[model samples]
Target: MLKTLASYIQEYKVPSFKAMFYVTLEVIMEVLIPYLMSDLVDKGIANGNMNIILKTGLFMILASIFSLIAGALGGKYASIASCGFAKNLRKAEYKQIQDFSFSDIDLFSTGSLITRLTTDVTNIQNTYMAIIRACVRSPLMLIFALFMTFKINSKLAFVFVFAILFLSIVLYFVSTRVHPKFKKMFSKIDCMNSSVQENITGIRVVKSFVREDHEREKFSHTSDEVFSLQRKAEKLLILNSPAMQFSVYVSILLISWFGAHLIVSDSMTTGELLSMFTYTINILMSLMMLSMNIVMLTMSISSAQRIAQVINHKSTLTSPVNGATKIENGTIDFENVYFNYGHADEGYVLENFSVHIDSGSTLGVLGATGSSKSSFVQLIPRLYDVLSGSVKVAGKDVREYDLKTLRDNVAMVLQKNVLFSGTIKENMRWGNENATDEEIMEACRLAQADEFIQKMPDKYDTYIEQGGSNVSGGQRQRLCIARALLKKPKILILDDSTSAVDTKTDALIRNAFMEKIPDTTRIIISQRISSIQDADKILVIDDGKVLALGNHEELLKTCTQYKETYEAQQKGGDFDEQ
Candidate 1:
């Protein structure tokens, strides 16, 4: 955890060290003020000289002013350190999300990731501020006050030292026990975040099923568990205050007793005794500050460990060392490809599969839900690597070229189409950043999206709510297709993109693909037999294996599985149920 904090600080190492230096100087100055006040009481007041009293009083005031100035400077430095750390943390976490592969994303719950990025980061930031201020200043104050006490009377200083040792043992024990509990608290928080997020995202399903009470009860259970863990941790931490006060009270009593002995012996003057008592108060107060810092240290350590777990994760997928293929007029080829979602030694998803696709031709893939149709196309962009064999684009192995070069030439429209909050044109621009107004319109027309878009309140300028919630399912599908069309890549993939649209609109969109998007290779994955009936070539897949390969008529003649699927579709596809 300490190593992680250091790495986080290293993000702004130069500025952070500068801040530490300034804070140290401020703490030193702050400790000196009480000593100056002591001098004013012992030397100035005891002398019975008005000039000495006034001069020392003025000097004490100067010390206080200097202390305040140092404190302000320290605060300025601390702000720079903490905010800079937070900015670096956000950048690193965002990069991690982008680098994660499909499998990597599947390993963690989405709401847990959100909590780590948001709430976890906040906890670290708060703890960092405490470290820069109390963590540094409190120890310095306690040490300096001890030194001043010993300078006046070593015997009384021993009383102070005894109290500190006892407090240290107590703090060490409590902090050790609470460390594991703080970590557990954060885990519980992540679980609670997941419960709340799932409820909100699936609120519609809950309402439709009339399960509001069920959901509320489920969420309440998670919340209560988190609350219970938090209470347990806080119960231990609450011991800090009384323990600290008890130590301070004992030290004060010891000091008072020693001062009384000195005054009776005339070995210490009344004014000097008064000065010792004030310094003792300062020492005890610093110890109280130290106790609070110890608790914060525990919290920060737990948070740092969680953040480090994320930062240190190695992404399974990475760009090729040599770089990606430079694609032009996309041509895709699969050569005896073998793949598995598991490790290399595990069972394969696609075994010894081989196919070739030419430029300007469309290859339609028909499959059941587990048939690896989507997985096969995902290989073209190298979303995941094949365990054995190669995927080539434009006559070169994809691994030989950089990832960006390969993706730049390909556009994939996933089955689950989603839109972010933005105008219709803004979402389209995600496909082509420099796309012209004419190009967007042409792409929309090709997608059969222009008809309904024009019907919208602002046409191309229409606002799309988050997840395109304001639009119907079919309309969202069309806009997603339009967005991909705007890219104008060499290869276009529609992974059942037309599932929500009516058969007529789906046909129009397919016709536009044939008429307007010439010279671009297309791979369409769908379960609907009619959707792929007219393709130049078609592959029927079942249980991750290709059962047949041919045009619609050829498949009906040669393949029983293909024939049965086609007959079932003619009756009414499962998509109708959806």
Candidate 2:
């Protein structure tokens, strides 16, 4: 996981190295100050030598100034390295998500992905800063202080060494206990984000159903779980502070007590004992910083693994090398096509579904809920690949064509019509980036969207709210259809996209398709029989199998399902068409 994350530090390597280098210089200067102070006290002060006192004090001040400068430079470089590394990491994760197939997206939720891209990346970024700065400074400070202590008095150095050993043991115990709690806490955070996202996205439904209290309770439950886990982790973390204080106080007493005996025996100088005290404080403070960094590492270890999961994942779907780029016609054939949502144990959503449509013909699809109507059309654009057999377009297997080229020629307005927040013209341009105003208006007219758009004060320039919330369902559906129409695709599919529009408007949109773009193969999926009764061919499917396939008149005579649906819709006033 560390290796995977380290790869994103590509251009920030220099900054990282410079941070460590400057920190090393800072530690060196700090060690020199304490060493010089010992001499200033033992010879300059004890002997009452004014010259020696002045010279040694001057050297100590110089070391102090250099340490300040080095510390400042170290902080600057660490900031640059960490923030740049985060940028590269965030870009990598986002780019990888773009490459994922629909199946890959299914394995993760929108909320989880958002958390990984944002929260998880932030955790890793903060940890990176701590690692480059404190991780280098603390260890180097401890080592240099210990070296100076041993040089001044080896017997007193043992006191610092024993204290270091005791603190390490305590830190190990705290980290081990705390790490699992922190790991679990972050996972709970993912769940909380998922709940929040789902609630906000479906806030209207919750309001309509009077379920705001239920959503609030649900969110509170996840939030409480996160709080509980973090509190438990922090309970263990609090041990570090008391442990550090105990070590510092005990080491001081041991050094002071043993040094008094050495001084009485004329074995150690007063100045050396005072310097030993300073080195002890330096070593203990370094340990405190090290412990703090360890706490950060414990938290970030979990976050880093979460981030690695996203970065290391390879999309199962990829375009073929030197793939075919041209689609000859709108002709589509399902030849013994067997498919599931990449879950073989769940049975196929489309089971050996074989059908052939001639170029530029209109086909109607009728099915009950769970009939996989949308799944059938999705294959035409290669949104999902078949498990067995092949889905062919333009007399070639879909897998043979370049993914972008195949999808470009096939436009699909799915059952859930979606529009992004933008001006009416910008949203339409998603269908054709280079489309002119004349071209866009023509497509909207065909989709029966031009009438409503012109009624708005801004017309083409009207701003759409997020998720197209500013428009009614019918308008949203028509706008999506218009966007698809702007593609000028060879094959256009409406997967129950017009369900919200009245029958009269639906008929007008269908009539426009037939009249203005007769050569573009149109496949319409609808539950109401009236919407598809005029098609050249109608397929009635259930449970991933074709129950009936024929023209409207032929199916009325032969297929019980089609006849019953048509009669039921007619009796219920589903349409006024004769």
Go through the candidates in order and give the clash count of each. 5, 0
Give lDDT for model 1.
0.80
- Residue 213 lDDT, candidate 2, scale 0-100: 92
The sequence of per-residue lDDT tens digits that candidate 1 reaches over residues 1-578 is 56755676765666556666766776666566666666666777767767877887787677677777877777777777888887778778778988888777667667767777887788788777777776777787778778877887887789888888888887888889888887887777788888887888778888999999998898788888878877887888888788878877887787788789988998776666666777777777777788878888787777777677677777777787867456766888889898988665756788888888888888889888888888888989888888888998888887777878777788899878789999999999998889999999999888888998889889999999988889988888888988988877889999988888877788899999999988889899877777888898898776666677888889889988889888987787556544
Residues 21-123 of candidate 2: C-alpha lDDT, one tens digit per residue: 9999999999888788889999999999999999999999999999999999999999999999999989999999998888888887777788888988888
Q: Which has the greatest lDDT?
A: 2
| TM-scores of all predicted structures | 0.94, 0.97
Where model 1 places Cα greater than 4 Å from the true spot, the runs are: 1-22, 343-346, 572-578
Please, what is the whole-model Cα lDDT of each candidate in the order they appear? 0.80, 0.91
